[model samples]
Each structure stands twice: as structure tokens, then as C-alpha cells.
Target: MMLPLILLYLIGYETRVTTACSRLEACNSEFRTGLEVAGIQEPESSAPYCAELRAYSQCIKKANKACRGDLSFHTSTAVIDSLMKRFKCAQQNWGPPYKRPSVKPKSNSICSHQSNSEYVHCGIFGDPHLKTFTKSYQTCGAKGAWPLIDNKFLAIQVTNMPVINSSSATATTKVTIIIRRVPGCAEEKTFEATSDAPLRPFFVDSSYSTGPEGSVQMKASINKTEKVEIYLRYIDTTLVVRRVGEYLGFSCRLPWDIAKIREENALELCQTGCPGTELLDIASSRGHRLSWETALNKCKQDMDLETGVRNNLTDQYLDWCVFDVMTTGKNEFVSTAHLAQEDVLYMDPSSLRNRTFPLDLNGIPKPSSAAISNVTLNLQVTAVVDRCGRNVVHAPAYEGAPQVGRVAIKVPPIWENRIPVL
Candidate 1:
């Protein structure tokens, strides 16, 4: 009887082990299928690919759990570690698409090429050496002809720009410039400073209606290192307004260096605790309102201290750190009331565009314009970190790229009498 019982027990144990092994193999097969569906035939660093790989990792984890009691079944730690490394690689390569800043017209004048030609070449009036052509113009000598001439023209030249103060934290610089026009072209000249510069108005040629009436004046200021762009405006001979350059500016490296330092600092903070944690705690105890930007900066500083490097933090790593901090603590908040109010007032088609007589749940006619006032109520506001970190709000869909993560934060409302109904 004892011999028979041992044989039965051994047989049962073997069957169980075989089943567990089969399940593990099935999990691996499913993971491979997921990779194929995700187009991850070869290891490539991309957010979508990494996300798919993570799904495979999850499958492996589930299989490991399912086979927990089986002595012969186990998840491969080496494979998991490899997948994690690949995920990190993918994240490091992902970010929002780059976009160029739009140019805002400084004057009321509108400028266009004089002819319908494919190419228009423009030259400064005074300087024989200065000439530039538009890239979008038709081919030269096609129909409109080359060397498009304007009676009135404006030119911008950067004489000297130097980085006076340079630091890893910030850089200060000065720009000196000059504007000149063709002799007897326009009756006046107006010089417009770049966005970052101090606005100084210097007008020349009072006779020209298209240009600002006055003379050229040079203005300089200490500023965060940035590109120095100057714009020139004047009226052409036909009394048509024309602008010569869009962001015709000088570039430097100081600003970029400072940005790199800040990024590195932010990454270090995410990896480790922010410096002076006790001080931060005390401040929180005293009801200090910590701004999101400030908190982000603090994290950057901590990162810089740890790595002693600049610009080593990628956008993905920073985003992950932000999400982690936001979800783990009450460091942020979103005003649920404001969002709800906005949805009712702006998003609802009936409320915003088409008005209809609708009855409220209380059997009262709903007002054309909804109002919420003079009522003290306890409302729950969600934490901003939680919303952004966990992706509760889906990111806008992109056509060709992975869905990028985003954080939408609402500003706290201040008390004001008679808030306008949106």
C-alpha cells in the first residue's frame, strides 16, 4: 500500500510540473505574438514599441504568478532586466514634435513680393554687401524676373553682441545693433526690437508714410542669453508697406548651456530626494503654497548636484519623474469645480451655441446663462499630479508618432465679485 501511494504521488507531481511548464511556454509565445503585432521585430527605441514590450513583461509576470506553486517553473529575471533597459532606451528617445515659434507683426503694414515670380531677392538699401532672397519665391527669370527691387527697403545688422555674465544657472548678455535704409527710398524708418529686448523706438525719414517718423536709436539691456532679432519696416515707393526680415537675429551658445545645466539638475532631483527636505517640510507645515514650476526647478537642482553634469536629463525621464512625484504626494491639485463649470459653460453645445428651454432636475426652468454663486459647499478637487502622471486625461492623438503624455494644470481661482458667465 505504501509503495502504491508513493507511485501515485510522484505521478501527480510530474503532471503538475508539466502543466506549469506548458503554461510558461505559452506565456512566452503570447509575448512573442505581442511583439510581432507591435512591429517590434528588432529592438528599436520608441515609446509605442516600449509600451508594447511592457505588455509582454506583464504577461511574463502573470505566468510567473500562475506557476508560483510549481517547483520547476520560474520567470527569467535576466529577460525582465533586459526588457527594462530597452524600455528606458525607448523613453529617452521620445518627446513632443519640434515647432518653430510664430512671428508677430510689429506694425500695421503688410508686405508681399511685388511680382508673382517664383523667387524674390531683397537687398539692404545702404550696404552694397547685404542682400538676401526669399526661399519660397518662384524660379528666377521664370515670369516675375529676378532681382526684385523696391524703392524703399530696410536692413538690420548686428554689430556686436557679447555674453557678459555666464553661469551654469543663468547667463546674461548684451546686444548692440544698427538699422539702415536705402538712400531716398522711404520717407521714414521704424526699428522694432526683438521680443526679449527692451522696446526702444527710433524712427527716421518723416516723409515716408509706411515707416515710423524719426531717427535710429540704439537700445541695450542685460537679459537672459537669447537670440538678438531686429526688424525693419518702411513704405515702398508705391506707398505699400513692407517688412524686410523675420527674426534676422544673431545666435549664441550661452543660453543653451544654461538650459543643459537646468535639465541635468531636474533629472538628479527625480533620482534622489530634493536637498533640504527638512526645510521643505517646515515650509509645508507653515502653509506655504508651492508652485509647480518651483517644485520642478528644485528637482532639477537636486539632479545637477548628484550628477555634476549638464543637460543629461531627457524629456522622457523628466516626465516620468514628474509623474512619480505628483502621484506619490499631495504636491499638486486640480480644481474639479472649475473644470466642471467650464465643461457646462463652454463645452456643452446647448449651453454655448444653441439655446433651448430646458427644465432642471428640480422642475425649475434652467437659466440661459447658468450661475453658481453664494453657496458654501465642500467640493473635492483632484490632485494635478495624479491626473497627469496616470494619464487620466488622454493625450491628443498623433497621426504618425506614439501618443505623447501631457499634463494640464488649472490655476486656482481668486475671489472676485460678479464673475462673468462664460
Candidate 2:
């Protein structure tokens, strides 16, 4: 669970040291935000970022006087002491003339925007199907935490959990996105979302964005579960991370130039899509006894009702809805499918209907609603068999794209069972 944000310091004039220390906790958080402002996402290697460390040390040292009383005071000091020691801040000069190190921008920088950026789209949804920025598509049993997007300006990660207790099949349950500080635009931001505690519109710092970058202001909040959108003004990007069923889903619209195939992003899931894995066709999974007619009709109806944009944005989502319904025996996926389509439309208003994606359906499926009946769901766990003859291994994942892995990882692709679930 995330700590409740404490931005306001409510220290009273009472003489009780405990009260002062309690308030000092707020100062501690405020002091740490300096790191965020410095564009340091990972605090583990914050040693070289000596400026922030010194600020924090000074704050703690000042608190040493009034914040003395209980074990909390001692404990807090111990933690801060350990952090400073670990970073070896004592050896470094926090004095004048001590220049701070530079943080190299990530390989995929966001300073450039091309004309085709409006049509560049990528997403991750049910069954962990991924659509890369290049319009490539693949369904992966990537059953652990994986980076959907990692660039100099932004990073998105998803954690997949088993759908059923004993099944190897998994879905995303958590999503975390990091927005690094832009030189003159937005400050660094962090956001977290889980199935139970979906994301809100604001960042962990309780701020939407650092005063809007020019005429276009950055957007930080959107509805949860249904569809969550965050507009990054600095990068000119829109990120959609949502919750569906027992998991989470992510989507993004980037400028084509920013999505160029680079050495570092060759293996990014959102950049290169998932590797070829013969996924168990959920629609044909045995024992599931699922009825796709209802979902097909539902998603199709929603798409048909939309008059604003005459695009086939719902094509992939329609397929995803049917697949999720067949896999989980639930029809809510129909709404999620509709939501994804609408989100894509809102995220990018370009003529996407004319744009071609690798996994685009020729047209929306036409399902007859004449015989709408209650879908029968039989959630029987089935064996997972790799449809392909290839041996399964814990394939390493990349940060920028799923092709070239730069981040160290221990996640293993454990879904050896290509078994279908009801």
C-alpha cells in the first residue's frame, strides 16, 4: 500500500517533542521530493545526486533537536543515517563549487515530434496481448512484472498475476508509470494502479503537472477502471492505463518519430510487441463452453453507435473482448472493449480508420443479435500446453522496447501449459 501523501506540514506550537517529530515526518516526505524534482526515479543509486541527499541530511539534522523523544525519532534517524552512509554522502562535499552529476536522457528521448506521431499507438490488455508502436501484435504469457514502455521521459510497467489459482494463465493486476522531470516542463511524477485500488487523476505528489508547458497543459487525471488517460505535455504523448476483470490494461499514443526502432528499445513490449507465442485460441479453448455471439454483438453494437470517428479502432478490442469473455466467462469485457475503442479515439483524433496496423481486423465483426441468450460460463481449469514445439524459458524483457533488454531481470516465462480455461 502507498503511504497517504502528506504535503501540508501541520506542526503545532506544543512543546511535546512527539508532536514535533510527527510533523517532521511530513518534512521528511517534502525533503525527499527533491529527488523527484531532480529526475531521480530510483532512490537506490541516489549517491551521485548529492544535492538532494545533502538537503535531506540537513533536514534530518535540524529535526534532531525538536524531533527527539520516542523510538520513532531514533528509528527515523537510523534510517536516514543508513541512507546517507550507504550513499557515502559524508565523503562528498555538499559545499560550493561541488558540481552535481548529469543524468543522461534515456535512449528514447521525447524532445522530437514527427507528423506521423498522432497515429502511433500501442496497448496491453486482456490475456496480456500487446500492440507495439509499430503496429505489431502478439499475445504473451508474460506472467510477471514487465515494462510496457521505458523511455527518457516516461516509463510504464505492468505486473501480471495468475487468473486462476492453479492456472499458468495470467493477467495484469498492477500498473506503475514514471514521468521524469523535464528540464523546463513538468516535474518528475509517479503513479500506481491496482485492480482493487485503481488509479486517480493526480500524481503521487498530489499534483496534476508542473504549471502547464505553453498553451497545452498536461493532463494527469482520468476515470479509473473504465479508462484512465494521462496527457504528457512535454512529450506530446497520451497514456491510457485501465483495469479489466482481475487485471490491468495499458495503451499509449506516441509520435512516430519518437517510436523509431532504436538499439535500446528493440525489445520493449510496447515498442516491439511480444515474441511469437502460439497462444491457446481462447475462443476454441475446450470446456470453456463460451458464447461469443453475445460479446461480438455487444462490442459491434458499441462501435456501430459511435458516429464521431468512423474508424475501426474497436477492431482489436472486439477481438480482445471475445477472447476475454471466452477465457473468464464474463461479459464485462464487452464494455472494456468499447472503452478501449473510445479511449483510442480520444487519445488520437487522426484518421486512424485509414491507418493500417499489423493486427487490424478487416472490418468490425457483424454478429446477429436476433438470438441474444445468457452466456453459459464454466470456469473449469484446463491444462496449459504450448501450442508450439518450442521449449519454454524465462525470456528476458527490455526497457525501451521488448527487443533489446537493458534492465536486469529474473522474470521467467513460466506458462508451459497451453491449456484453455473456461
Candidate 3:
């Protein structure tokens, strides 16, 4: 999938941040608890954001220093103030105020009074510059440069959470979470989704509720990375609260080379190493040039170290050499009995005429035999892009090194009885 241009911004961020975990104990606790609330572990042991946070924090620190260190503090605070102005408090009145009967009580303001049943806290965080945070004037419609967020880990808590579905046996509240200090546009980007449904407009209390319910306090710190932490709370009884959570760990950027390494590892694990020496040599020689070669070689190397796995590399350049000889009977120097086997063997008259034959009882007869004059070996090779897929070459022409004449035989004529079959 084509991820948004935000990926580019993350690449830059990765270099600047160093230590994302300002407090080891606190970060670990948050991670453990968050995982418990999430119910499942993060993918590939990447849960809790401890590792990513550390890296992001260090990167941000570096970037901050380069941007003038303490010089930018006042500016950042100004930016934060501007951004926070968007969120306005909604009004609410729990009950009538207690009063001594001495003096007349004053009426409550609209910010404090509300009838029951209406969602009292419904309010919008407004900013004319909100959308501009993620975009630049140069790139219209394209998500512009992503700004660096303060690496602070802020603890967020939502308690007395609102009930989105008082009727349903199980219902989730949804809240729209906009990343604070995000640059350019506020084009909504979701973290990880539980199912196929997009999680955004994210929920604060429930997965669907719009407002912050109850007192949910999440511990956050400065210089920490941003990861999606979803806390699910349930009540076995009203007094006892239980939580399960699922979190998505986001790296400032995608680990492209790391992914390639994983693929290589998996391939080696699956195939028990590659098929041939030629392929191994080619991979070793050219691995630096292509991701495919590097990945294949790394996998082969790992598989070689693993027990019960043998290197039989065949999909590499060396395999091309091995298979070429096996198919054409041109390179008689290679041992074929153990490497390449076929139900049948075909030979071209020209090849059979001049080639030195291996003196096996099962191999082709010597060139001096009477039958050699009428003998013709029909060899064919097919090109295919994938295993289990149709052959790409119906009747491919065989090309040898310049010193050797290339051979191309038309399909029907090569197979016909009139072509002087061997």
C-alpha cells in the first residue's frame, strides 16, 4: 500500500530522537499495564512503545539542539498555547448547590448548568491554523512536512467515562483524537485498526464516544515518542474495574531494510538455504546492488547456521549457470547425477556431433556409432516468472556465450518426426 508522504517526515525524525523513555520504571509500567488493558501483545514484541520511545526521544533531543536548544523553548511554548486554544470546556451542573439560608444565592452561569440526558460536555477544539499544521503552501492536497512533537510522555486519564450504549449488551464509545502539535493539515490519520473498520475518529471513553468520559489518566512524559494506546475498561461489578488494551507502536519511520532482512530470514527458514554454488557466488558478489540479492543471501546464511537446514540455493545467478548446463548438456564438467535429474534427455545434432560424452552406460552412445548419424537430441528450456505459474516462454531460444554459437529451434519442426529425430 502507498502510505502517505508522512513517511518521509518520519525518516527525518528517526535521526534526531535518541532516548524516548525519560523514566525507565514509568515507561515499563505503562507498557505492562497498557498491554494488559489491550488484551493482546504488540506485533513482533514491539508493544508498549518503550524501545521506540527511547529512540524517538534521543532523535528529538538531537534535532532540538540543532534547532538552537533552549533558544526555541519560548517559541515552542507559544506554539503550544496557540494550539491548546482550540479546546473549549463544555458546561455541566451535577446538582443544586448547598446554601446557608442567610443570603440570597446567585444563579449559576451557562458553563455550570445543564439538564440530564443531554451530552453536557460536547464541545469543539477550534483553530484556523489546525489544518495548516500538516500541510505546506507548496504541496497542495499532498500532506506536507510533519513537525516534531515534544518528546514528552503525557499521562492521559479518562474516568467516569460516558456510556455510549446504555441499551446494548456491549457497545464502545468513540472519540476523535487529534494529535496535538501535528503540522499542516488535520487530515485525520488513524493508528492501527482492530478489525477492518477504520478506528478513527477515535474514541476517548468508548471506541465510538465523542467526549472524554470519566477520569482516564494516562501518564505521558516529554521527549517520548507517540504510539497508539487503547485502554478498554470493564466492570465485573460497579466497584471493581478491569482493563484490556491493544496498542500500535509507530516508528518515526518505516524500517525498510529491516523488513528486507526479515523476508530473507523467512525465505531461508522456509527453504533451508538456497540450491546451488553458482547462485551463492552470485548473491555474494552482487548482493549490495539489489535488495532481493541481499535478502536472499542473508536468509541463506541464517539457514546455514540453523540445524536441519541445508543450503540448496537454486533461485540465484549461480542456479542460472547450473540449470543452463543441465538443460543444454553443454557444460559436461558439472556433476549432474546428484544435482540435476530428468526423466528424459534431448540433444541437438550439432551438440551431439562435437561434444565429448561422459562414458556412462546410460548416457548417449559414442559419436562413432552408426546410430549417431541419424541421432538428434531435442532440448528445450522454458522461462517462467513464478513457481506454479504458467511458463512465460512458449519456445525460448537458447543463447550461449559469444564463443559458442546460439541455438534457436522452431517448436513444431523440432518436435516433428520429419525433423530427423534421434
In terms of TM-score, which candidate is strongest? 2
lDDT of 3: 0.21
Error of 1 at 325 (Å): 20
Model 1, span 342-369: residue lDDT tens: 1122111111221111111122222211
lDDT of 2: 0.49
Query: Lowest-lDDT window of 10 residues in candidate 2?
Result: 1-10
**TM-score, candidate number 2:** 0.50
Q: Report lDDT per candidate.
A: 0.25, 0.49, 0.21
CA lDDT of 268 in candidate 2?
64
Q: Cα deviation in Å at residue 95, candidate 2?
A: 67
Q: What digit string (tens of lDDT, one per residue) describes model 3 on residues 196-242?
A: 13333233323321112321212221112122332211100000011
Error of 2 at 261 (Å): 6.7
Question: How many clashing residue pairs are found in candidate 2?
Answer: 22
Candidate of highest lDDT? 2
What is the Cα-based lDDT of residue 418 in candidate 1?
Answer: 16
Answer with 1 or 3, whichever has the higher lDDT: 1
